[model samples]
Target: MGAAFITPGEIIENSSNLTPGKGTIEHEGKIIAMVQGNVIIDSKSNTVSVKNDDEMPTPKVGDYLIGVVDRLGEKAATIKIIQIEGDGRSILPEHQYADIYVAGIVDRFLPAPVDAMRRRDLVRVKVTETNPVLKVNTRDDENCGVLSALCPQCGEDLYAKPEGDKNVHCPQCDYSGYRVLSNGFGQGYNLEKNGAAAYNRLKQRWSKEFDEIFKAGIPARSVLLRADHRFDGRKITRPNFEGSGGNNQRKERPKGTKLFVGGLARSIDTEKLKEIFSKHGDVIDAIVMTDKETGNSRGFGFVTYSGKASAEVAIKELHKFDLNGRKITVNNADDKSSSKREKKPSGKKIFVGGLDWNVNEKQLEKLFSKYCKVIEVSIPLNRDTGKSRGFGFVTASEDSADKAIKALDGFELNGRKIGVRESENKSKQKNNKNQRSTRELQARREEGIED
Candidate 1:
């Protein structure tokens, strides 16, 4: 049998002349012997082989290989697989592994070649075809390989379209390109021009998609549920402001207790007013009227307490209370005289004084409209002159008349103080006084005759 030519690292033992064509010798533990032809001797395993000096070619399947992405298209990534490593005499030749085609780079989402593979991400790949090796005429022609186009603007998928005459433009960002180079994948390549615009388009698309996905999964009702649950199980109890509780309770007044709060600064709001009155007793309600349009606080407001005792306490403590830089008056509302108070009178007519001369019945009606319905505004006219005397009587229902008197008594009109007094018959009062005097004189005459 012909001996195989041994390469370096072949175990030889005790041999002196270890040349290519030598005789039998032992160097380390293995035997080195000269054979007739090219063959390998496995001294340890007792196997003989023929020497095959042919070098292995590079390309192989299932081997991790580095290549530049040359021509990236919408449907595929074209890789020019350049370098290969393997035996020269294999069933599948190494040269045949060049110029591989990988499809669906644009349609499917994949990480950039530089990103390290992560467990969370899926790396899917398919090998389509291996091209036959062909002899190239020129070295410069070898550089004309596929290049993958990555959007220079947004780092997203970019499509190619023919530009005006000689160039190709990226459909995504209008980036124009003409040159091609190898991508890392050996097939995909980026266009020489307009890479920036392409990247920008990709970035925008990616951002929009991300935002939509983020918003779609968020629950709208979660916020409301959280707020409601914050106050769950809380309870509050308060005595009824108007309901009777015990025999000691004073006869329920026909009129509810009226609380006059005076010490509020114009800045005090209804809430603050209520808080102040609540200290004295349970307050039914507090209202601070304001100009609807302006939203400025009016100087005065009303607070109704739960009972007369609370109302009295509030009036005493808060009457002179200093609120918002002002002292306010708090007191019991006064009752009007019977004749002036009666809204519907049998024959009584009260005089309203200190009216402006220009004021008319309609003007008076509008002023008192909130409190009562005015039946008349009779301004006494002089028999000699048809002009008004600047005063008028307002006749309303008995109930409303009293309300009007109470509301309007201290009100200022036309820079003058107004007075509302009970109307009486002057002649009847005078006659009654005279008759009482005559009866007294007759009683004295009878006493003298008896004496």
Candidate 2:
């Protein structure tokens, strides 16, 4: 028969029969205790009577039980067993009370051992026997018993030290400290291999119970089956390697000159540009000119290289590279004369290009007057025709020249892109000297003299 509870003063006439006692009988196994006298049996109630001959199992010493750590002392630690799984039955219900004892812990050694066990440290033990005196009542202090003590530092059993010994040391860690438990065995609890097993079991039991109570209505069984089927189905899907286009479809790096990649398929943007140019080295900056009103590309843009060498390389390699069906133009960044003059902090001559054929010195000054006070606008005249060339030169104070260059470099006139660059004064000077020398030579030759 399964273990049952009985109370004292109840006459257990036989294994299956019982007589009402003067008090309430609480029975664990065959052992009956008298809880209250004048017992009355109510058939409608759940309580039942047991016979005297029914065997009762007792909790002996060296019995391994599941327990939770409750308290940690300097020399010893305490644990309380919430559930006892065996022939022995608890005097009270598992939920009503817990059993605590010192012998079941690792503190059988010294008076405050270092690295002593503490509360919430789960342990497993072999119950050697029970303390008859303490087992009489279902009280906290009465549930004490002896068990095997395992040292926390070393896996060895703790032995009693000789008289007057002040310290206990573990040879493994060479940890020497006060003993935690001085009474039953030694300091430190030896955690058993089954310690974790008990913890897992308890966790599983409680988790199952919690799920049952909180999730009773949910279709958990169906969900679990569906999940298992999905896992099984995952093996059939193969990875697609051909989905990614071949290496040729991959982007190539920009090289040589800065390419003004215009007519960009509207789909291309800054990100696409970087992907195209990143191989060249490093793209210093990339700007796509856009129409402010429509927020679309202006069909032209520029990418700057870190060095002129890379720019030159980019120009040669990528000048006419096809990008999204458009033939891109790659060249040195157009040197605008006005921009060069502005770049110089000192007053200097500026070369301007991409001018309208009709635009002359007076027209240039009128256009630039809005930006700064133009000192002069000199459109170089063709020597043969004495007509204004499309390009011209501009001179201004250093500050005004910079402002004008910035203002006019990208400004549109007659629907044409203009180029501006700083003029090399030294080269111009050397050319003028060469011309004068040649003229003097000619005159000397005519005069029949050496130059």
Candidate 3:
């Protein structure tokens, strides 16, 4: 063979025949291949070597690189190298990832990578090392740092703002923030100015605004931390922060009395909700659920009254009542029954249908408990919204099942008559094609009306 294929640790030739070179190593009395490649025999030097079939070009010291901010830490940032400047060859897979420390971002003191560059920012850096690990730097470089970035708030393209307190400004939103800017920022690859020199001309030290907003020692002054009035369409409403009682200890309320308030407008918050429900009786607590990422209302909440009678009054009066252009629903919060707890198949079960969206499992149990000894109650809920599916199952004593069904069937609760009957095999309904829950059907009907 002109050149033989070899694998790592495979014997290539005797040590006396061919001296070890490159991918080959001398072992005992043999020249062994150290890597998987094609074996090469150097005739002039009389040495054996291996050549990789798929070798890739790597970045060298002093070479500039283009990358995106992949991950961040308190002291450093991980950059995923996208392109090597002035080079057409691709980088090796193992050498594509690089790290840029806080010190390498700029000469000034940076608390973390977030202050200098955010995730998904396009940055330019100079390679400082290629072995052991890829290391890059942006310090004192006019062409380095962020080339392009989007506004963190409104997702609009940010423009260079040298005159503002922050280095970048969003045209579509009121977001102004700092970044380790490059000479080519907002200009793509065509750079005409020295960014580092311009940055040096501005205030070199940290400003008071920066200290209050991001510094650890001072209280957070970011707009995100404050409860401000948010505008929706033409309406304006402010979100409620839980009262400050020194510590965050919640007040004690009777168990199994929490109420679910649904179909609320996005503008409604705890304060407004409490104000509307407080007329019935003393409201212990009220909470409006909000999105974790965006900090916006999810249009539903929970309320706790001082007594069950007050809870019933709130539900009866507020369910299907209009507030802020929406028909809100109020009912008992779902909870496991505190009555006789028995395993499955221990009692007679009944199917309850035509339930109001406000009705919860606890309410169903309470209704059945009046006629018979309740064993357990189950009401399926929407996984995404945690709202009632408007139906439930109740298990009761054998003798009381028929009596309870007879008395409770067609009973008016929350302005709607509910159907209660012996439990049937629901597996067929589950297998039925194109079947949707009551809420889904209602949503689809509403969508059709809009169209």
Candidate 4:
């Protein structure tokens, strides 16, 4: 018989017999087709899979799975497998969960589960065992394992330590750890939303999801993760000639190697820009921004080098350096989050102290107004006399507050050399005063004994 037409929610296969496959979902002890397609049963695998008219990518046994390390357990890891290596798209029908046991991970003996993998490590594993539960093996794979891993202490991508037995070092911070490096290691981390979302899916294994795949039925290939794989680094400023090949290679551009070159002349071509940047380091690929249709320079381009260090050197040397009369800006293309985090703090609240008894809100506002926007001003007063207390406070923009303190403090305001600085909130102020008073009392006792 030809493949049978199937509709969503229609039970196509029984749980006791065939396993669920592509375009299928498991609910209430039955494998139901989730897509409108023809159901095809694989006799060898005894699994029912739905085949759409158009070729749809169905993950099969032995397929290479790529994802970030999620949770590490006693002997297994919760891997958030996002895509199969051969699958063109990194997307899935939904975020998938795959579990692997200690034995299924690698060939060599790992003393502890963590020795095999670390959190946030991007890994590649091949499905070795598949049944109701998917099993993967990262062990004994010379070419695959962890492609990108970070330093545990600093979260910076690691570099091949100056010299070691396969140890990786954090470039930003001095910390190193054991690693299971793939053919390509020390590539920068891709901290994008999708990548984060992939890991976050494992935060919970909801009852609805357990019934959907894990708890009562065959694990769907679309969201399968097999454990029992042995799991498992490093920066090297590798030279370019070895791998420098094509423009498309840049599309697979590694993290730190990519550079965003802005402020380009409309006349400048990709080759010219590449030549200009190549002096500082090896340029793997270069592309001048161009019109989608007309194919003309958009006055900005990207240049990628073989490694992060090389790209950094090029950026530092070329950033704002007059290039053919235009000072071009060069920076890491993937440093968007890092750039935002590095911005200086502004409008921070600061405390003001040591005000003269004569100081009033109006006077304080007038004094600090020259520095920054005066948001509010308060002067605590003596209730009986209704005059200014020994001290008061001034609240202003961070920049203005900083300026006010520097300019007016200790200026003999109203015959008193007033002090000014960041203010501790009232509770903290009381606590500090109490602590200081204790110290003063202890000092007085010691002085009396000496006398």
Candidate 5:
């Protein structure tokens, strides 16, 4: 008779082969105890019971019970009995429902509780003192009631029809439910999430049985199934950056709130950028792009804000403004390079230096068009003198640029040695060969930061 006492949801046995009896319930392919009690394994019957000293509700002959209509089977309807009147025992959300046989149902001669008892409708019944498991009868009780319920489709409160067909119907929507409603059916009470009063009522007024299960800290996986769906503690999974903040904990902006700052001067550091941008809004974070190996500014970085409004304001005020001698462009992190990518910058742009001053765009295109697809050829000329500007640019495919670099570089063409190399956007690059010593400016520079 003596057994090991355990708390609610404690694993009584790892095996689900045995049947859960009395205060025990089967969950997640395992039989777990539902109360602080003894784990009773009956080998002969192949059954388990959570026996405990706590005064759990026991079925007594002719005792009135309060229960919710769980569901109806062909032979019987299951009732989630919550309270046993006069015995002072209540049904908990964690406590599983018990089966109510058809014979025990009121109006035994009738086929079923048609237009009478609906699923989720609360009811009152009398205990019949049944065998292996307890059974209750709702055949006769004027005090019994259908506490509260909602429309299956629209989530509006189901109003009871006391005069007509006597079924519950949604006043706002075309939905109905068969229920034996007492005086407390639809007088402005509901269990829908949107019902402010009802939600608070459910939260504040659950019975002691539900309170016990609530404080038990039931695992999340099985929490939704329980009667009380309240969680007052942190989840088992920890926050990622719990204690990473230094002496003073710094607030962090949300992931997408970061704005990418491109075309920045290499001399601008995180603090300097933060100081300038904080004037527009509250900057949560400011990180100047730096080389991983050498730890130097790579001509750009990111600034973050706690709110979307702050980031938008920062972008509008600070974009294209001079910062540490370089005009910085500030855009949202996602929109930063995404719009830039649409302008065709993946391939190389070839630069043609040391031109013969006589070569035109057509003549240059005629030369490199033999190597690869020449996108465009531009030979600048003076309007007053009408002569070549000494140097021109030949834009071609990346593979073609490589070919032109190897073939035409330092090669005599039209009696002049022409120099050909990858085109460089020398606008943003401050050439910090003197300022930064810690890290090399190689982050986006190699990928054409100027682009």
Candidate 6:
């Protein structure tokens, strides 16, 4: 019969009549192949076995190994075993990897494996177990530790510094840190001459400064911090004085016209805003404020004219003006703060709901104007459609507010019965003091710019 190709863990013989041979083991009275090869049944010897022509050497216990750190975790680190010490034979592909846990890093207590070695560090380790998985130890021998390593903060060579808090220090950046160092650490120090005494001179405990920094977290260093000094050919220069190169200072001119344009259509851009406002006066600057993300219009913008007369005319003619089939609001951009300082509006704000989409600020103002002198009327519109949100706010004298609420609470206007009441919101004048825009405007005024 032709020999059958067998693989590891494959049953070769089911009876005890055949004894297990090399590359095979007996389990439960069955002969199992331990390697991938052709099964040989020796009838004369009454034995079965499997054999492979090629087999790579694997490390045994108590053998020293040279490897590089591959991965680091909080509890353990993986090492890629390269060569078995004093053995030039290559390791089997399946056994090329090993691991060294935090407890195996040093005799002293370590918080993590990184405190001893980092990835890509060349290390010498002693094999501890090789059956289920390869395990190595760095603290077993003084010579079995990191032979070469780079600084964690700065990518420079680390020198052994037994005198400092850590075993290693970077000469360029003055960064000191610890490592499970070998006797032959840095520049290939002769272990025979060094006598492995330096390896045992580990600090008994972490210093107070190191403990604090470790608890606080590792500090990050950037290449830009040392770029200017490292590279002399391309040096970056900084401005010696404040407001240099026209960065911090705005161009000075007469207090020109600045108008706040609200209720702008979503499709409008800076060019469209400039085109529409040009008819009023020479448009020095026009902008349509947009969302930082999405780049869509914010339903409000600012416009600047060369002269204040042009601005006053725009506010008069364009307030509640219709453009793009939507009614808009126009007011002096600087008037909000100025009006509060000059004369605080004395009134109680009344909320009006169930407003028809057709209703506007003019209609609302006229309705409340009959009861008392209306201080201001605000009908917030949907930013997208530029349509009224079916509600508005009106400011009137306290006595007039009661009269208006009683009269207009259920009064039908343009087909909808409106709901009216004393606004629950506090005075906007007091709230404006805490607004971000108001704070920015106050800052700009404090920068020596006139209204």
Instruction: Report the C-alpha displacement of residue 16, candidate 4, in angstroms.
Output: 17
Question: TM-score per candidate, in order?
Answer: 0.20, 0.20, 0.41, 0.33, 0.31, 0.39
How many residue pairs of model 1 clash at the backbone? 65
lDDT of 2 by residue, 1-451 (tens): 2234445544433323443332234354332444422223444543433434543434455444545445444333445654454444543322222333433333222222112333333333344435432111111111222222333433444333422222344444342322222222322234243221121121112234333422332222223222322322232212222323222221444443454555455556777876787677568767566664466655567787867777667766776566664446665566545643223334656778888776766678888778776666666544334445678888767777777787788677667667766666777778786555557878989999964
Q: Which residue pairs of candidate 6 clash?
A: none
Candidate 2 Cα errors over 4 Å, as ranges: 1-57, 74-76, 85-109, 132-451
Candidate 5 Cα deviation (angstroms), residue 6: 4.0
Give the runs in model 3 whose Cα sits over 4 Å from its true position.
1-55, 195-197, 200-203, 216-451
Clashing pairs in 3: none
Model 4 over residues 1-451: C-alpha lDDT tens digits?
Answer: 2486877678886778878888787778899876778998888888887887754455567787787888776568777787877676534344365666776655544434465467777877777655666566666554446777766654666664423223566677555544555544544333232221222122223334223222222212111123222122122121232233222234255444788888676668888988888898877778887774466667788888888889878876887676544557788887778653334334545555667666766787777787778776666544334555677666677656777777766767667777777776567767676455546778978889432
Per-residue C-alpha lDDT of model 6 across residues 1-451, encoded as one tens digit per residue: 3387887888888866888877788888888877788888888888787767765466899988889898776678999998887777677655789988988988876777766777778888999999799999987578878888776555677787675457777787756667788877764535544633364455377778556544532211112223313422342222233232222223454367788898788877889988988998999988787764466777888889999899888888887787765567888888767543334467988899999999988899998888766988888777667778899989898777788888888999999899999887556757777645657779878997655
Query: C-alpha displacement of 262 in model 2, angstroms?
Result: 99
| Candidate 5 worst ten-residue window by lDDT | 195-204
Q: lDDT tens digits, residues 1-451, model 5?
A: 4576688878776554788887778888788777677778788888988877775766667776667787665457778877776555555453335667655554323234422455666666667755656676655443344556655445566765532322567787565544544443444223333221221121124345333433443232122223212233222221233333321234654454888888766667888888988888878778776664466667777888878898899988987675543456787886645645325434668888888877777788888887767887766555334466788877787676788778888978789999898887554346743543223456547667642
Ten consecutive residues with minimal summed lDDT in candidate 1? 113-122
For residues 54-76, could you state the per-residue lDDT of candidate 3 as single tens digits? 65456889989989988776678
Best by lDDT: 3
Worst 10 residues of 3 by lDDT: 218-227
How accurate locally, in lDDT, is each candidate?
0.45, 0.47, 0.76, 0.62, 0.62, 0.75
Tens digit of lDDT per residue, candidate 1, span 182-246? Answer: 12212233223333223222211233433342243212212222322233333222223233322
TM-score of 5: 0.31
lDDT of 1: 0.45
What local lDDT does model 6 show for residue 390?
91
Clashes of each: 65, 58, 0, 21, 6, 0
Instruction: Tell me, by TM-score, which candidate is best.
Output: 3
